[model samples]
Target chain A: MSDKKISKIKIGIINLKTNNLYSIYNAIKNIGYNVSIVETNTKYLNYDFLILPGVGSYAKGMKNITENNFNKRLIDFILPGEKKILGICLGMQLLFENSNEFKMTKGLGLIKGKVKKFKFIQKTIIPHIGWNSVVLNNKMNYFKSSLINKKFYFVHSYVCEPADINYCGTKTFYGNKYFCSSIIQKNIIGTQFHPEKSGKAGINLLKSLLK
Target chain B: MRFIRIIPKLDIKNGQLIKGINLEGLRVLGNPFEFAKNYYESGADEILYLDNVATLYGTNNLSKFVSKTVKNIFIPVTVGGGIRNIKDVEMMLSSGADRICINSSAIDDINIIKKTSRIYGSSTICSIIEVVKIKNKYLITKSNGRDIVNKDPLEWAKKLEQFGTGEIILTCVNHEGLRNGFDIPLINKISRNIKVPVIAHGGAGNFQQVLEVIKKTKISGVAIASLFHYGLVPKFKFKKNRIGNFNYLDRVKNLNIKHTNNLKKLKLFLKSNNINVR
Candidate 1:
C-alpha cells in the first residue's frame, strides 16, 4: 500500500513571476517535499512553508502582489513567523521596507531594509551579471564554506540595504559595495542571488533550505 | 576570465542564408557555410542558426545542415528551429553541433527543456528568445514573428535556468535586421534575470555596438551579423573594464545552493564515477 498519510511536509509557493519556477519546483521535489505553485493553486500561501519568487522589476512585482491581493495575505502569512519563508531576487527585496527600483514603493517590511539603485560602474556594467564572491555578513545559513569564497549569480541594478547588520548575511561587489545579497531574520530568509539560478550549488542550497 | 565570445547569427531558410528588413534583408544573402567559415576565421567563438520555418513547417531536421557546416568549420555550433524532441537533440549532438535552441516547444512544454538538459546535459540546450517590442515592453515570438507569447523574456529566462537550460540566445525581433543597436533594455533585464550564459543577437550595426551591449549586459557572448558585414574590425574599441559573465556566476551558485553536504563524500563519489561535466 502507498503511504498516503506519511506526514508529508507541505510547501506553498507564491510564484509572483511572469514565467515558470519549475527549476525550484523540481529541485524541491527531488528532496521529497511536495511543493505547489501558490499562484496557480490559490491555497499555496497557506502551506507549511512558502517561497516568494520575483523575476522582473521591483515595481512590477510589488504592483502585481498588491493588485492581486497577494500582499495582504503574504503579510498575514509571515506575521506569525510560524512558517519558514524564503525570498529570491525581487522577492528578497520585497521582504524589506521599500525599494528604489522604478519608483519608491512600499515593500512587505518584514525586515528593516530598503532596496536602492546602483551607482555607475559605467565601464563595468549596469546589471551585475554572472557570479561573484559573496562576503558573508555573519548569519548566512546553509553556508558551510568560507564567507570570502563562493560565487553566485546576481542580476540586479538595485540592491537591498538592511538597516541592521543582523539581517544582512552576504554582500557582493559591483560599482558600490551594497549589502543584502542574502539575509536571514529568524524564520524569514531571503537571497538576492538566485540559488535557483546557481546550478549545482543552487540545487544543493534548495536542499538545505528544505531541511 | 574566459575569453568573452563575439558571435554573428545567420538564419537559414531553404538552404540560403537570410536576413530581412527587421529579420528583413529583402533577399537571400549567401551560403550559411561561407558565412560560418568567415566568422570562425574572424574569431567568432560560435555560430547560431534559427530555422525561420521550423514552427511554420513543424520539423527541425537541421542535423543534415549542421553536419555539412561542421565539415567546413572547427568550433561549437548552435542550431534552433522546430527542436521539440530528444531525437532531434541527438541529431544535433551527433552531427557535432554543440547546442540546440528551443522556442515554441519550450513554451508549449517546459519538460522539453528538462528532458533534453537531463539527457544531453544542460550545456547543449540553448533557448532562442525572440523578444518583440509590444506595448512598450518585450514579448517572445516564434516562426518569423508570427506568434507572440505574452511571457516576459526575463521571467521565461529564469524558469529556463531552473529547468537546467545550458544557455540563452536573446534575439530582439524588434531590432533584428534593423541594425540600429542591440536591445539594451531587454539584454540587461534578461541577462540579469537568468544565471546561465546569455548571447545577445540582432541589431549590431557596428563593432562599437557589440562592445556597448557587452558592457551594458555583461552577457557571456555578444553576437553580431551587421558588424561582420560592416567590416572585419579586429580590436575592441569600447572601455576595457571587464564585467562578470556566467562563468563567475556559476561560482556564486556553487557555494549558495549545493547545500552544506559532506564535501569529501561528494567529491569522492564524483571522482570515482568520473562524472565531471564542467
Candidate 2:
C-alpha cells in the first residue's frame, strides 16, 4: 500500500456481455497499465488482478458468467491461484453469497455477505445515487490521507451486508441507514459504487489499486 | 456533505449540441463529444446531456451520441430528454450513460418511475422537474416548458421522491437562460423537503451566482448551460464583442456572443470562493 513503483501491472477485466465495461476499461488503461479484455469463459490467467465489471440484474450477470463457463476459470484463479479480484456494482454483488434482486440467486461466495434492498424509515429515494461521503472503516495506505472524507459516486438500490464487520472497508449513509459501500478480505475486494464513473476521486482510487 | 458537484448540461437536439433561451429559440453549438471531453479535462464533476427534442420528435437514437461521449469522457454522464419508459432507460444505460433523466414521461405515468427504480435502482434515474412561477405559485411544466401541468411544484417534488427517484433536477424554466440567478426560494423549498439529492439548475450565470445558490439552497449540484457555453454571462457582458470564428451561435440562426470563462476557469473561481469542487 506504500508509494511503491507501479510497474508491469497486468490487469485482466473479465468482460461479461451484460455489463458496460468501457468506463472501467478506459480508466485502467488511461493509467498507463496493461489491461486486457478477458472475454468470458476464457482460461486466461496471465495477469496480476482480475476485474469483474457488471451491470443489469444479478441473475443475468451470473447467468452470463455460468453460461459461458467463465465462473470455473474465475473460481480457479481466485482460490488456488490466490490472485486478487475486484468486483464492481453487479459484479460486486456477484461476489456475495446470494442476492434477492430478482430472486434467490447464488453468487461467487468470495465474500460472506447478502445483497439486500434499501429499507427506509421515512420516505426516501430507493437508488441512493449522486456523490455521498464514505467513512473508512479501516485505514489503507493505497488511499491518500484526504481521500477518506471525499464523496464517491454511488448508484444502487441494494447494498451488501458483510457477515464480518472487519470486511467492511468503507460505509456510506443512504435511505436513513449506513451500509457497506465496499468490502475487502485478503485479495478479494468489491465496491457497490462505480469507481470508474466517480470522476477524479474514482480515477485516483483505481490508480492506487495498481501494485 | 462533500464537494458540491459542478455539472455541465449539454442540450442536444437532432444529434447536435444546441443552446436556447428558456428552452426555446434554439441555437446550435459544437460537437457534444468534444465539449464533453473538454469539460472532463477542465474538472467537471459530471456531464448532463439533455436530448431537448426527444419527447417532441419521438425518436430514440440518443444512445449513439451517448456512446461516443462515453468512449472518451470518463466522468458520470446523465442523459435526459424524451425518456418515456423503461426501454428508453435501458437503452441509455446500455449506451454508456451512467444515469437517465426522466421528465414528461414520469409525469404521464408514475408507474414507470417505480418500475425503473425496481429494476435498475433509483440512483440510475433522475427526475427533471421544471417549474414556472405563475402568480406567487411555482407550477410544474413539462415538454421542455411548452406544456404546463396542473400540479404544484412542491407537491410534484414530494411525489417524485415517493416514487423512488434517485435525484431531482429542479430547473426553473422561468429563470433558465435568463442569467438572473437561480430561484433560490424554490430550490430551498424542495431540497429541504426532499430526502434525495436535488441538483439545482437554470439561472446560474457565473461562478458567484453558483456560489450564492449553493450557499442559499441545500442543493447537491449545479447544472449550467449558457453560462458555461458562452463563458461570460451574455447579459452581464457590456461589450459587444463577436465570439467564435464561424459565428457559432448564429449557426442555428441566433445572436452573436463570445465564449468566455470555460469549465476550467469556473472550477477555479469556485475553488477560490471556498466552494469545494472536484
Per-residue lDDT of candidate 2, residues B59-163 (tens digit) = 666888888887767788998888888778877877888788898998899888888866665677789999988887778888889888889888888898888
Error of 1 at B126 (Å): 14
DockQ scores for all predicted structures: 0.02, 0.41
List fnat per candidate, in order: 0.00, 0.42
TM-score of chain A of each: 0.87, 0.92
In candidate 2, stretches whose alpha carbon ends up further than 4 angstroms from where it belongs are A1-18, A32-48, A56-73, A98-106, A116-128, A132-139, A142-151, A170-180, B1-3, B135-137, B232-259, B265-276
* Strongest candidate by DockQ: 2
| Candidate 2 pairs with clashing backbones | A127-B122, A127-B123, B231-B260
- Which digits, one per residue and each the tens of the lDDT, describe model 1 over residues A1-211? 1345322667866766432254456456655668887873263366777888655556666766786677878888888988889997778888899987646889888999788876654444444544556777674646644334555556555678899987777777665445568888888888887665454456567766766
TM-score of chain B of 2: 0.90
